[model samples]
Target: MKFRRWCRNCNCEQEVAPIMGYEDSWRKLFWLLEFLRTEETIAEATFDEYMEHLMFFGKLAFDADDEIEKRLKEEEVSDND
Candidate 1:
């Protein structure tokens, strides 16, 4: 199976053939979190701004899933009609 990488910053997509192993991918994700945690500066505000960004991204992801489901349901209804 082939995997694809999407760059949100560059708006580019490329297919990666013979993707890395599952364990490697998991490790990469862990490393990425660690890097973000250590490298990104968190302001000394009342709340953790970093966490706010994470929550925002999480909400966006959930919203996208909800939208996809809604569109699929609408399509199904239209097809039945």
Candidate 2:
């Protein structure tokens, strides 16, 4: 799957592919989000950099949710068959 994301560093639109295996993907996203939050809370990165990371993480979360939903729907259909 493809997702359009705004790149703050390059100041352009970039295409992203998110990993989609339910548990594995969620774990990956959870770690990424935790790292971002910790960095921001500790002021480890500059303001611009922190915001950029937040945006990227948010986009990933959105894609992850979409992937989970798609997988569930597919399973439902298969079960009904």
Candidate 3:
């Protein structure tokens, strides 16, 4: 599924796909969405600004690790069922 985030320039939410050459980071994008949910500045920051933030500091969240762990747990549960 495509990921969604707020865009200050569009003055509404926007969808984004995995960036070229970084398809593995789609999970990170999901993490970014969850990260943005509680953030206050994205509402004031333009889409480019957001991209810049992603480019520079996106990997700090470690959400992908949590997501992977959760999925593995789900697989284990399904296997047991």
**What is the C-alpha local distance difference test score of candidate 1?**
0.54
TM-score of candidate 2 to 2 decimals: 0.48
How much RMSD separates candidate 2 from the native structure?
10.3
In terms of TM-score, the best-performing candidate is 2
Error of 3 at 67 (Å): 21
Candidate 2 Cα deviation (angstroms), residue 39: 5.8
Give lDDT tens digits, candidate 3, residues 1-81: 676666646647777653442555656564565446426756456767767777655555466667888999999999999
Order candidates by lDDT, high to low.
Answer: 3, 2, 1
Error of model 2, residue 32, in angstroms: 6.8
lDDT of 2 by residue, 7-66 (tens): 547746665554453356446664454444444453467667666766777788788889
Q: Which stretches of candidate 2 lie over 4 Å from their true place?
A: 1-43
Each model's lDDT: 0.54, 0.62, 0.63
Candidate 2 weakest lDDT stretch, 10 residues: 34-43
TM-score, candidate number 1:
0.46
